[model samples]
Target: MKNNTYYRLTLLAVILSLSVTAATFGQGRQNRLTNSPREGYWVIESQPRQKSVALFYNDDNQLIYKEVLSKKRLNIKQAKTQESLKAVLEQALRQWAVSQKTGGNPIQNDQQWLAAELN
Candidate 1:
């Protein structure tokens, strides 16, 4: 019984240590964009064919936050122009920041924002 408990405990510790190490290394190796068009506002982190991950920054270029934007999340039916897409992303980020300041309560319906953005 004693040997079984020790083995289980050792296994748990190893698993936990590996998880922490992976998380730390992953954060240290973030893939930041080198030539984002919206450099002043946000940096594109990852852009899959359909979805995009972005990291917003303040005026001093300090990382403010991150968000993932996709057509499904925004309820968009068609493709958006580049300028319009940037505007929508900026607006979503601002709304998210405000929501965070206000106790993380969702501010409005996502569909509402999408409709307003699309139009």
Candidate 2:
């Protein structure tokens, strides 16, 4: 009887641990930006110490631009043109919004803007 009880307790503990871990993982993803409208210009506020990447898109869902605004160096090798810069800015803004909702510190600098201009 004692062995059976011990086994059951162990199983319960394992189940509880798994549940807690799953919950945390879900929360982490929720903290990041997910599916959001890829239209217009967005303003992104990133953590003072981290680099931010924003993405901009046109009405047809084409990747028009991308930008990486960072306090540190951001190695963007494929970004060219204003469109690409706009795409990057939009994505960064979405991420910043999500981060803010999830308890991340507000962006300290107000220098980032992502605009998706129609061409």
- The candidate that achieves the highest lDDT relative to the unseen native structure: 1
lDDT of each: 0.55, 0.54
* TM-score of each prediction: 0.30, 0.40
Give me candidate 2's TM-score against the actual structure.
Answer: 0.40
| Model 1, span 1-119: residue lDDT tens | 99999999999999999999999887666632322334346455444457655555545575545555574233223447344445655665576568768877653433344335556
For model 2, state the Cα shift of residue 2 in Å.
0.7
Write candidate 2's Cα lDDT for 1-119 as tens digits.
99999999999999999999999999887754353344555333355588665544445454334455655433334344344454555555565567658987544332344323212
Q: Which stretches of candidate 1 lie over 4 Å from their true place?
A: 1-80, 107-109
State how far residue 106 of model 1 sits from its true place (Å). Answer: 2.8
